[model samples]
Structure formats: C-alpha cells, structure tokens
Target: KSKNPPFMQWTDEKIAALAPNDSTERRGRTLASSAKWNTIATNYEAIWGECKGSGSQPYLVQIKLSGPKYKCSCPVRKPPCKHVLGLFFLFAKSSAVFKYQAPTEALKNWLDQQSTSTVSSASKTLAPVLKTEEAIEQAKLAKQKRWAQRVQLMTSGMDELELWLTDLIRQGIANTDIQKASFWNQVAAKMVDAKLPRISTYLKETHLLIQQNQNWSEVVVARLGALYLWAESFKKRNLLSAEMQEELYQSLGKIIKKADILAQHPSSKDLWFVLGKKEGVDIEGRSFRKIWLQGQKTKQQALILDYAFGSMGYEQQYIVGDLLDGALVYYSKAYPQRAIFESFESAKIYEKTTLNTYKDLNSMLTSYGKALVQNPWLFSFPVGLSNLKAFVNDKKELQIKDVKDRIIPLSNLKEAIIWKILAISGGHSVSLFGEWSGLHFEPLSMLTEDGILSFT
Candidate 1:
C-alpha cells in the first residue's frame, strides 16, 4: 500500500459535486468499495485505476490532479463519468489502498496528449479566425432575415391564441369539457407548431389545474387572464422598454444563448451557496433542471436553468450545500434572476454557521411583492424564512407558521415530504427555503442542525 499523503484534498461531498446527477452519484458510491477495482495505483502526478465490468476488458480510469482532468475507457461521453467519480471517492477515502508505482507508458502518453491538446486549444482561441467585411455583412443580413420570419410566425400564433381565449370566455367556463385532453392539446399543439413553446407549457399547466383542483374555476380564470395579457403584451412589445421587451421574449420561450449573455452582461463574482435543485420532464418530454444559488457577500439569488432533449443529460453538475467561488452573468430582465456562469474557479463544502433568512413570512412576502412589481410575469419566487414551525392546520392542510403566528399554506406536495418536514420541526421552529407562488409555498429544502437537507 502507498504511504504518501493524498495528492489532492477531496472529500466525499466534493466527489459528489462532480457527479452530473443523483443517479451518477449513487452509482459512484456503489462502486467506491476497494473490492470493485481490479487495480489501483498512484504516481506523483496522477492516480490510475481499473475496474471490472460486464465487458471482457476492465475499464481503465485516470485522474490528473493538477488540472483535475479525467480520462476513462468507458463508453460514456460525459467527462468524469461514474468510474472516474468512483476512483475519486476511493482516493478521497483511503489513499493508502493505492500502490505506489512508476508512470506506465500508456499513462505517460495520455498525459502528454492532454498537455499538447491544452496548448493547441489555447493557441486556437488566442488566434480566432476573423471573418471578412463581406462575410460579416452577409451573416448580419441572414440573422435579420431569420428574426423577421420568426416574428411573423409568432404574431400569427398569438392572434390565434387570443381568439381561442376569447371564445373560451364567451362560451362560459362551465360549458367547456375541462377533463377532455383534446380540448387543450389541440391549441397547445398549434402553439408548439408556431414556435411558442412557453405558451404551450402554460396551456398544459392550466389543463392540469382544472383536472386537479376543486376550485379550478377561479384558478382557470386567473390563468387565462394572464395568458390574455401576455398575448396583448406581445402585440405592443415594440412600444415597451428594452428591458421589458427582453422579459416578454423570455416569457414567450425565446432562448437567449449563453454565449450572448456572457458577452453582453456584467459578471458578479461571489461565494455562492448552492441552495436547492429541482428537475423534471415537461409536457413536451424535454427534461429540465433548475439550480438555485445565493451569494454570501452580495446576498443576491440566481437561477441556473438547463434543458436536455431525448437521451441527453445536463452539461454541468452541482451538489446542494456546496459553495462555488465563481462569477455569474445574468440574463437581461426587469428583475434579473436567471444566470449563467461566466467563470467557475473552485468548489468545496460549505461550512457556514448560520443561514441568511427572512425574519418572518410577512417580510418574505413583502420582498416577493416587490419583485412582482418589477416583473409582473414572475411566477415562482425563491424565499428563505427563519424560526418557522411546520404543522397540520385544523383543515388538515400542511402549513408553516411564523414567529408572529401568521400561517401560510404549502403547495400540493407529497405526503412523505409533508410528514418529513413535520417530523424535522417536531412542532418547533426550523429554517426553510422554497418557492412562493403568492398563493402557496413549495418547500424544496430545509436547513437542519447538520446541514441543508433537500426534499427534491
């Protein structure tokens, strides 16, 4: 067994941070046991290991600690795949298990290739190919043409949607067969075809509300009113301020590319705490993930949204409760929240003594109302509250009560989650973080004695 100290300082949480998703993290944990590896060795610069798999040949994995780069012979395309994470976990747990060995020729070749590729990529970036004046003008014209065409399609689609909404209101909400899928699906399909996926999502969610809620008549009316307002806003979008116009575009599902945001927006550097994460597949079968972060210094919140098509996974991985030392560039909006990382320097486990939270429910709601005033289309707003007790009200609904004894109902959450919260609080006050929709709160995570515990 090797007697040298571990080359890098890594903990189990740090290794978990490298996993792209919870599934990968669990797999890595399962493979962390020493018996899973056929061989494990380390040199001065790197760690290499081989693990047996279903295939005839064992999968080889290598980690270069300086760059923290990883290479695996497994078929997975994503870097730092489960095998690599497993090796990291092993080394982090017990480096003595790895035998000290000289660099093998194969390992040496891989290292040399990495160095050469790094230099080559840097040179290419430093000397990017510049387009000629004619090429630039042509590209500009092409982009303008595409935008004009898309605007025309969107206008027609919004017109159709407005007519549909008018007819629904004229025909009376009671007359419409809300349970029938085709009634909503037909219009939603048209919206998708019109390249207005965000409106399509709204329609689907309205349908779900009608199906799931007892007082859906009121909910449906409010939802449709918002949709109607959005359609009208689209018509007068040109007259709106630039920031409001950007908000409207985002609300309509127009994607602002990361490169564009990074190039245009100012970046804020801070020690950001990973608060919570939520992920699910939408009605369109596209998988989406949202990670929430709060800056320790600026106290600003940011939302990182990611989407993947069929069989594809998210590009980055983040573990809740970790601290990221980085800079983030936010998308343009009346009230900026969505952001993309401009630079990620380092990440580690957070060792904070206290959480930043609102004093009470009233204070949190006041802040939320202010945000809504800035961006009327805002749906869900993140909030954290301290000294709140969770319990079942007299109506048998799960709710949280603040220090002032004012209570707020929770959103429709799983029974398990509700019970877990109640159990954690034990009729006492606990700090909690979640999204507030002005109507109900949806708890995602809670700060406990140990650390932040995620519910989803």
Candidate 2:
C-alpha cells in the first residue's frame, strides 16, 4: 500500500527519472557505476537510525527525501550509503527506465561540453570559450548595475518619508493625532518594521510632545510610509510583504479606531511562524526587504511582521544571532486557527540546570527569582509558591523539600533569572488573560495562581 493516494499524475518514467544515483555529478561515473546500488523508491518515510551490530549505531542513517533521496543506516553519516550505490548499479544493469537527472546548471554545462569539446577536432576553434578577462569585466558591471538598482528602488519610497518624519519630530505626534490618530500610528509602526531604530526615536518624542504640549503638523504626511503600505495591503492583501501582512492584519485587532467591517477582510488562514526557516533562494534572489516578526511575548497572540529579505525578511528555522531580538518563522498552517511558532534556539537554552535538582530551600527560591525575570508567572514548581511554607513574594513557584522525602514549598529566593531577562527586555506589562481563564503555559505573560499551583 502506498501512503500517497494513487498517484494521479505519477508515472513510472517520472519515478525512474528521480533516481538518486544521477543526482550527483561525481566525475568518476564508471567507477561508481560498478557499485551494485540496490534501492527502492517508495513514499519517503522518516529518517530512522538503525544499528545492526550496536557499538554506537553505525554513523550512517537512511533519510527519505520526497521519494528518491535515501540515506543508508550504515557506518557513514553521508547519504545514499552503499545500499544506494548498489541500487544505482542494479538499475543501470537492468531494463527498467529509472535514471537520475543532473542538476540544471551542471546538466547544461555538460551538454555544452558534449556539443563542442566532444565534437570532432574540426569544430574546436569554431566556438572558443569567452575570454576570461572579458567575462570578468562583464560580471563586474552586471553586479554593479544590480546593486545600483536595488539601492535606488529601496530608497525611492523614503524620499517624502524622511522629510515628513523629520517634520513629525519637530511638531510632535500626540498633537498631530487630533486630525488623524490612525495615520500617525501607522507611520510609527512602519518605522519599527523597517528596522529604522533612530526614526522610532522621532516618533516617540513626537508622541510625548503631543501628550505634553499638543503640537502637531505633518502628522499624516509623516506617517505616510506605513499607512501607504497598509492601504496598499487592503487593496492587495496577498501582495504585501509577509511582515507587513501580519502587522496590518494584527493591527486591525489593535487599532484604537476600527476600520469599517465593510472593507474586504484578509481571508487567509494563520501560518505558524516556526523559528529558524530557510526557503530556497527567495532570500537570495531579493536582496532587500525581509519579513520579521517580533521577539516572543507573554501573550501568544502578538501580531507578526514580515521582514523583506536581506532586510530581515530572510527566513530560517531559528533566530540565530542576538537571541532576544527576533524569531525565524514562516506560515505553517491555515484557516482561522492557532498557528504554532517555535522559539527553540532562543528559549531552549534555559532548560538545563533546572531548580528541580536543587536540594536547599534557599536555592529553590533562587531559581524562582531567576524565572521571574524571563516570566513573571513562575510562582510554583521547583519553588514553593504552591506550598504554604515558603517564600513570601505573594505566592510564586512551588518547591519540595527532600527532608523525609516530603513535598514542600520553596523559600522565596531573591535571585531569579527570569526577572533579569524581563528587566533587560522591558518587563511584561499586561496580565495577558482574564483572571479566571484557567489556561496555563501562556509563554508571554505573568503566570497565574492556578498556573503556579498546577506546576507545583
């Protein structure tokens, strides 16, 4: 039985074409051809590590890719083990049509060589390779031209924006909002999305001035960049950058003033932003504008922003550098739904040295103190928040004492690491949920009484 429904368009020829042996362009084809590679192309299953003789299972494992790519759980870590070698040999020796296709560029080059170099000596002088010096010059010019165009295009939208932003700072934001609050907010949001940290300074000062002095002008003009992007999004929702799409949609929920519902809604399902993702060449093809969603939060529902590639729209499976800044994510699902995003690399670092291993009440309290810095809701579990006898910080993490192997509360320790990161990142400021909502494990907010009690 096949895991794939009867292949609607799958043909034996197609399956043969995806043969793994030809996928590589190793120079020693004849030598490799000698190996009897025995392989079967079926629906790819998971990569399972198997050890035939133990010791430490052989270094190699078979990995199923689509259908053709396979790894042999042999003594090598590389792919297509001897099993693949044998499979290729068997296929070539047999009458079956299975054969591998070389990658596009390699195949093209090989074809060109076959046409020219393999021709009778008479044609060698007919089409000589382009002169290396000439090729280099052409390549350089092409690169220079491409960069010039990119710089020109990316900065083209900022002309009016720079002047407008400067004006907003001079006049102030809060005061300008009197005419249109949404406009000003939009600009502020865009600047943040653009990774223009300094510009945000201007927006903040303008906001403060508006609040304190009520002075505003060019508010709408200043915010034009972000608003225009959003308006365009409303007009062509799918065309907007990934970061912009998330920001604008989430913005609808957070807008102090709601847009009329009559406006067409973005009818796409939620795409989970799994941290650390890599897409083939989109990030490479476009050098500017990346989509970026913000750092993890206490509330799970925080809006996401797309980063233009090169500008941060670059996607990866995990946020690699500066763990605190942003996450690597992409849409993983659809429909009005709960999208799952991971913070594995950034958040998983704390999994070691847990307070559960601590023997003293003082140390347990200390661990809770650390947890409070990253999260304010860790009042129980490994601390004594759930038990009646420990730390007095209004009920926090629960801890058990080893005395007589009895359960107990952790004493309140002041040195919590969670509190440290929170203070550094800007302490979580909202409750994130209803008092009685009963849900625990909300990553972005203060943990609740029941949450602490549950962990205990």
Candidate 3:
C-alpha cells in the first residue's frame, strides 16, 4: 500500500468493510488466497454508502467476494470490502480471472503425488503442540534471517552515505564542492540499484531541499529523523508491533514528502516539554517529543500532542496520555495508535508527596515551563472532545462530574486512576491482576528477592 503512489486508485476507505472490526488499516493483513479461503469458506460482500471526505471525485471501492475469501480497502477494517465483493461478483458468474490459474487435473495429480510423498517422508504423526512449536520457531528464524539480510544491505549503504555527507560538511560544501547535478543524481540512482529505496529517496529529497528549500536545517532535521527511523526499522523489523510496523512504513513513505512537525510551533503560545526524543530511542521511530503544558487561573494542565501525525509535510512530535503507557497502552480508544509523550516517564507524575502537593502555580506547570516560560492556558486552548468529563456546554463552560473533586481536567481520568491505585498502595507497590479491572478475586501471592506478599 505504501509503495503505491498518490494517483494509485486505492484509498483507505476502500479498505474498511473487508477488514475485521478489530483489524486496523495496516493490520490483520492475512491476505488469504482462494485456496486458503477454501479451507475456512470465508469472504463477505457489504456496502454502506457514498464517499464522505474532502475529495470531490465520486470514488467507489467495495467488497466483491465472500466465503471463498474477499478483498476490499475501505476504512471499516472489516474484511471482504465492497470492492472485493464486486470483484467476486464477477468471479461467481465466471467472468473475471484470478491471479493464478484454476486447478487443472494434471496439476492436481502432481500436487497429490507431492503431498503424499511429502507427508510420508515428513512423518505427520508428530504431537500437535510439538509440531506447532516447531513451525513457529522455524517461522521466527526465517523472519529473523530475512530482516537481518535487509538491514545488512540497507544500513551499511546508509552509514557510508551519512559519513560521506558528514565529510562534505567538514570540507565545507556550503563554500565549495562538486557542482554537477550528476553527483547526487548518481547517488540517488545507486540507491535504487542497491534496493535501498528509503535511503535513495532520502538523498533525492535532501538534494532537492538544498537546491530549493528556504529552510534547510528544519528539512534536514525532519528527514534525518525519518532516515534514522528507516534505519532503525531495518534494525528491528522483526520485533516491531503491528502498529509500530505500520508507523515505520508510514514514516518511510512520508520521508520524501513530509516535514518535521517538531520544529513547527502552534499559533498559541504555550510551554511544551520534551517527554521523549526518538532521535535517541527506537520505540517512537523517527519522531520527537513535545508536550504542551497549559495553565488555568488556578492550576496547570497537560494536553497530549497525540500528534495529528497525518498528511502534514513535516516531522511530527506526539504527546502522551496521563494514564496509558507500556502494555496497558494497547487498550484504549486511540489505543495501538499512540504518540511519543505517551511514554511512561513522559506522562506519569504520580508522587507519594501529598494531596494537592503542588507548592505554587508556576511549580505546578509541566517540565515545559522552565524552558519556555509560558503556561497551559485553559481559557483559549485547543482542547479535545474525546474527554467526556471535560465536555463543554453551549455557554462554553466545563461540565463537572459529581464523582470528581471539583471539575477535573478530562485528561486526568487515567492519571486519576493511577493515583487512586497508588493511594491504595501508599506508593509502595502493588501487584495488579484481572480483579483490578473488575473480575472475581481470589487469594494471591507475589514474591520478590527482597520480600513476599501473600493474600489470604
């Protein structure tokens, strides 16, 4: 999907229906074949309505098949989208041809012989668990090997290029250097030859920016982050989560066209802090961290950047939510879709200090205040509607929840839960379990090298 250009006929909306509800735009991508679907009798065709977006063209793509597998690219995340349905409609009537030929008697006979011989030779009588484990191990090994090879090929070339560029900088390319367009053009050409398309594209973009960009440092920083991300992706392709993998691919795709959002300041004058820096870490890919710390008449607040990481031609810096991070982060509304500030260290401020422990208003501001000397303005700020507790009325006043002490910032829900849990444990430590999230509780015991806690 990333390989395809802007003019490519496919769009995100077309991917929706054919995918599972839990499936994401870049996930749940089994892409089963006709034979594969024959085993499960899968595939379904469903349609919703006309397109709804900023576009003017009447674009339509839907599921065209179901039961024997399907394909669609709508935003729904359900499989067998309307396009796949329509495609299969032709298939059901024997009109359209598949990517592969139909099973022939000759081919079937050969396959049968091969299957028989393979089964006999391989000993299919192995225990299911052992067989499954062996298959998984083999798959892991194969994937590791493939990623290793790709990383080896891409990184070495990029490293050489980075060093070469650094040398040019040392020799002062700004003053005098090679003038031939063929110099960089040839480098870009070599990247394609090496199959390092990401690096190749980066070189081409950098050359263009140097030749045409009004702001070179900003462009360089943004592209540098993306190139670093692609290199990191090559390094850890086997370990990336589906969401992270999708993000890596998305960043790589935008390396040629996007800008670094970290350098772009919002119109509002607010103190933003660095919660996480992707330049030094691999988890957030090629992004950086900046948290907006706004202030009210009485206290300060934090609004996560949850970087609107889409479409803007720049480097994006994402912020963290108060409560979600690490494993539990996988479960939430915007879930799997998280920003940089969402890191544990960046978002959490759980202190065993005291109730309303903030000494003064200035001290209460986020770490951003010390550097920017501004505040998180509550009166006129870009607040999100997702926070149910912070919903605004027609009069523009915050709706207060009876359960909360005063009108709590909607962003404090998750943070409040963590504080509540900490209060219960008196900030020592507590073992979390299914019961904590509402489940039948039973006696439990936890042990560490220092001590043990037993529930009776």
Candidate 4:
C-alpha cells in the first residue's frame, strides 16, 4: 500500500474547500488540465510540478505534504494559486503521472528554507520572556489607558447611533429612501471610524435586505429594534454580568487576541467532528470562513472562524466529516460558541454512527430560544434534526419539514443544491444539520445511511 498521508489523497471537494472563493475554485478547475503542466513529480515528502503560465518560464510549483504548504513561482499574490491547485488536481486524478524522483536543486532549496523557518518560528514562540516588576506595571497601565480611550470613543459612537435611529424612526421607514446606498453607507462609515465594525456590518446587511427581500420593511424594523435594544443595553453595561460585558465588547468589534484567550480561558479536549462550513467575502473584500464542529463526547458545538485578506488563504483547513482529537479554548461570551484550537492531535474519518440530534423542530427551537435569552445578539445558531424531509414549497423555495408537518424555509440556497438534497432524501426522512437564522434554516449537510454529505 502507498504511504502517502491523508491530505496527499486529494479529492475535488477537498480542493474546492481550500479555495478562498468560488471564483478561485473555478479558475483552479480550469487550470487542472494535465496538458498545462510540463512536469509532474513527487517524493514521499513533497509534490513538485512545472506548469506553463503567462510567464516565459514554466512556473515551478512545489507542495510540502507535511504542511500541505504551497510554493509557486507564479506572480499571483494569493496562496495555493491556480498553478498549485492545478498541480494537486492533476495529482489527485492520477498520482501515477507523478514519477517518484529526488527534488530538483531549486525545489530542495525551497524545502530547506521552509524547514529552517518553521523551526526558527517555533523556537521563538516557545521561548519565555523575563519582565521586570516596573515593566509589567507600565504595560498594565498602558493597557488601561488604551481601554479607557476606546470606551470614550465607543460611548460617543453609540450615542450618535441612538440619535440616528431616533431620527430614522421619526421620519418613518415608509418615507425614507432606503434604495440609496448612501442612506446606509454614511452611517456604516461612521461606525467604522468609531471602531464599531460589527455595528457597521449590521447596517450594511439591513441595506442588502431592503434591496433583496420583498417583505423588507418588517426585517428592517426588527433589525432596527435589535440595534435600539443593544444601544439601550450599552447605557447600562456596567450592571451587566461579566459574560454579557464580553458579548458587548465583541459586538462593538473588540477582538480578544488568540494568545490572550488561550492563556485565560479554560480548554476542553474532545473528539470533535467537523460538521460543515460556510464561506463568504465581506464588504472589505476579505474572505471569511466559518467551520462548525460538534464534540462527540461532550456534545458541545463550537465555531471556528477564520479570515483572509487579498491573495491570502485561511490559516487552517478543515474537511467536513473528519473527526479530530483536540482541545479548544472558547472566547468569553454569554453563550460561548466561537473557539480556537488550544491543542490538536490526530484526525481521521468520522465513523458513521448515531449523532446527538434534537428529536424534532420544536425541541431545537426551544433550545435556541434559551440561548437567545442568554445572548440577545446571537446572529445564527447551529441546529441538527433527525428524520427531517426536504422538499420544495409552492413558492419554489426549499424547506425541510418535520414529522409534525411543520416546516421551515431554507435560506439563500441554490436550486441545484435544493434539488440535490431532495434527490438524496427520495421523499424519505433524513438527518439534517444547518444554521437557523431566526427567520429560516440553511441546510449545510445531511447524514445518510452511507455517510455524511456536505451541502456547503
């Protein structure tokens, strides 16, 4: 049997998952044709290829199987550019095409450099620092000063936002020209300047809802109500619980550094199953990925959110349905869900078995209601229901119906994906997992007797 690692055995779906966006995935697919490569070779440790590109010389592409790291001579700023992806796609299709050979001198040099850098970085990270008592005190005071300044800025921003909402309400939603982009952009820009990016996103989302949905007035009113509630809560934040205070800070776009979270928060170790993922590009042109994981023994759900800017990819890659042994440290929140890996061990295919799912839609909804009571600003909640049937409603929208005949609409899904789910179900009940946005359910994956199929 071959000794290649699990990641070396790449599949089309896996390749697509690594892409930063749909457009990049498409471009990679286009470049996957074997004829585009002048050479394809592999060793136990790495895969190397030379692909024909716009440049005069064939771009040299090398992938270190251990890091699954990519190195391409192409000028593209984005990692795992088309050349690297194309090489992997070709290798996945026919590994026999890649002759086993020693690395070329240039490839050897790149590999050696990567090894050296990895070791040096690890050493620096593991090294401890000695800080004098005075130095520590100075740092603590500086942090407090920074926090006080931020509080002042955020307070002013919230006051301005409250006044804007009041004016908008007085003028009335019907009278407002919501169609104009500036109606939302101007306020969103102000929020950004105040370092309240999360609030800015809410305004932008509200604008999009008005443009896309037919019953937008209700949506807008509900959103505005939430904003008003948050504003009122901020005024009384001093009386809130520590968890609620953290939630408020996050809502105002304050980020707790990963190192701080790892140092301060408790870590839970468990066999975690990669449930599914969602990817999208934000208004700033940065790509974001949300991967949902469920702990097998603890039955706890955690979200791993990662983002990448122009030409960069996410720091980590998670394949749906894989089970990993890891410890996660969750950020402080009223209803903690987002987490980062504190430690990671082995990963393997999740053994198909019974999953912890809600008995029905009512059970899931009740649980969600409780969570909402804890974190009023919760955007989306993960849910899994067993024996749910997928079907299209009269309005040509996809929905999942429970045994009670109660149904919830699936949000923002393509017709093709909807039909695929229907075909998989064959009019029979199937286990479904997804996120519930108070208004609708978005099916991300489905479980079958055979295995789990990802719909993301």
Across 1-456, the per-residue lDDT of candidate 1 in tens digits comes to: 445553346678767767767887888888887899999988856889998899899999998754366889998876668899999898889877877888789899987776554321211333456999999999999999998898888999999999999988898889443558788889999998888999998898878767766767767877888899889999998988999988987888988767667767888988888898888787777789889999888888999888877665565667677677788888965788988886553344444624578988889888988997778778879888899978786889788888998886567788988889988899888999888876678888899887898887
Candidate 3 residue runs with Cα over 4 Å from true position = 1-132, 175-181, 192-196, 215-456
After TM-score superposition, the amount by which residue 215's alpha carbon in candidate 2 deviates from its true location, in angstroms, is: 18
Which is superior by lDDT, 2 or 3?
Answer: 3
Ranked by lDDT, the better of candidates 1 and 4 is 1
lDDT of 3 by residue, 44-153 (tens): 12211122223454223322121122222354343334334433333333322232333345434543453343111111233445458788999889978976785566
Looking at model 4, the pairs that clash are: 78-311
RMSD of each: 4.1, 22.0, 22.0, 4.0
Sorted on lDDT, highest at the top, how do the candidates line up?
Answer: 1, 4, 3, 2
* Two-way lDDT contest, 1 vs 3, winner: 1
lDDT of 4 by residue, 1-456 (tens): 355544435677777766656777778777677788888888767888888878689998888764457778887776668778888777777777777888878788888876555321211344567999999999999999999998888888899999999998998899443568788889999988877888998888888867766777777888899899888988899999988988988867898878778778888888888887888777666688889998888888999988876666666667776677778878865687999887553344444444678878899889999998888878879988887877777987777888787876557677777888989999898888889887778888888875678887
Worst 10 residues of 2 by lDDT: 433-442
For residue 437, what is the lDDT in candidate 1? Answer: 74
lDDT of residue 394 for candidate 3: 91
Off by more than 4 A, model 4: 1-9, 21-46, 49-60, 64-67, 73-75, 97-131, 166-179, 343-350, 353-355
Using lDDT, give the best candidate's number.
Answer: 1
Looking at candidate 1, what is the lDDT of residue 103? 77
How do the residues 311-358 of candidate 2 rate in per-residue lDDT, one tens digit apiece?
A: 232232222111222222223112111222222222222221111123
Best by TM-score: 1
